[model samples]
Target: MSARAGSFSFDRKDLSRFLFDLYDYEPKLLRKLISARPYVCPFEDIERHIPEDAKVLDVGCGNGALLAILLASGRVKVAVGCDVHEGALASARMAAERTGNAGHVSFLKIRGFEELPADSFDVVTMVDVLHHVPEGDRVKAVEEAIKRVAAGGIFLFKDMVEAPFWRRLAHNVDDLIFSGEWVRQVKTAKVEAQVKAAGFELFESLEIPRIFYGNTLRVFRRL
Candidate 1:
């Protein structure tokens, strides 16, 4: 699959090749994990918001694909990935080491948002994660994610939003079958309100079109 955002071309095949080059010598298990979960969005889309020499924290970092990309781009000074899955964390560590980013990036096994330190990272990212959070804890999760962002830092939130009837049905069915759980449709207005209540100023809210469904990427700055 290929996606173009401005001058950037996001080709899944090319990203797969890059991952292979980085993980070829690694263990078979790690290689398989990286191959299974390719980049979800174009690198340029995410890279543009990250400043040079910034400390980054990626919540729900599955297999560390995004973290590795950020570190490899040479724009990040320190990258930390926190996830609940042990297998994913292991793969993330291996990917970082293989890509020569182990020194700059590290993965932590965390149970929830409460474990993260407050105001520590310059860039905080939660990509495709909010929906996975339980309904009762979603708001708390977002608040914690916001708290991790330092003053004047950016919080990048990307996830699937409510779509049309047919599109939403397909999206939910796909999620149920593959993820073994119902996909919660995220309401953009509700999320924005939560961010605003937390003292974050919404700087950008973009809807990027995709083949099957659309994604919303919002950038917020903590005041």
Candidate 2:
């Protein structure tokens, strides 16, 4: 059978539970999923506005590296990371503790977008998580993510876009690595336009280079 044909479908909750056991079973794979390199370029354009010790949410928060970076920078007052993968949350907590930042973070295993409150956060961010959302729910996912932000608050979106060179190359490499989780090649271009249609005014869309394809750092205002 083809790898894609056999891949399992994980909603927010299932993905979270799977994450708790991720490293013990697949340490290297988990590491790649949580790395910072893929994000360095795009995130550079947007600034984290949560006050020094402010409330922040990391959606599809992988292992919470972005939150950790914000915490370490002394910019965030409190940060909550939510993911469908418990392993990702566990890894984030472990990482926070290792950095002497224990208790400053928490993770929620959401069944879906409904698990979160509306207008409860000062800022919401998603890095490399957009592509993982189930195809049908992506629009609702982004719309809900925007609602989680307080009025006048910002949404920081960073993800990959298809360019001739990087799309094929990165997708191939990712397919080789995780196989199942790599974004299905079909939806690349449509995602950003959808984000705009979902009501997010594009703040910026910067291309990061062959480090990856058209790297996008979209800042959306929740006004």
lDDT of 1 at 23: 65
Q: For each candidate in the order shown, give its overall lDDT on alpha carbons.
A: 0.76, 0.60
Q: RMSD to native for every prediction?
A: 4.5, 10.5
Compared to the true structure, candidate 2 yields what TM-score? 0.72
For TM-score, the strongest prediction is 1
lDDT of 2 by residue, 1-223 (tens): 0111123222323233333333233366565454424333333343334455667888887666566555444556667888878877777777555434556667788878768654477778876676666677887787778778776677777666555755646754764566466554435346567666766666655655535455556676665
My TM-score estimates for the predictions, one after another, are 0.85, 0.72
Q: Write the per-residue lDDT of candidate 1 for residues 1-223, one digit (tens) a residue.
A: 1111122223556666667666665678657546544443545577789998999999999878788766665668888899999987887887787656579987888888898755489999999888888888988898888888888999999887587766667667767875788878877788899998988899988877555666788999989
Instruction: Point out where model 1 deviates above 4 Å.
Output: 1-13, 23-40
* Native-referenced Cα lDDT, model 2: 0.60
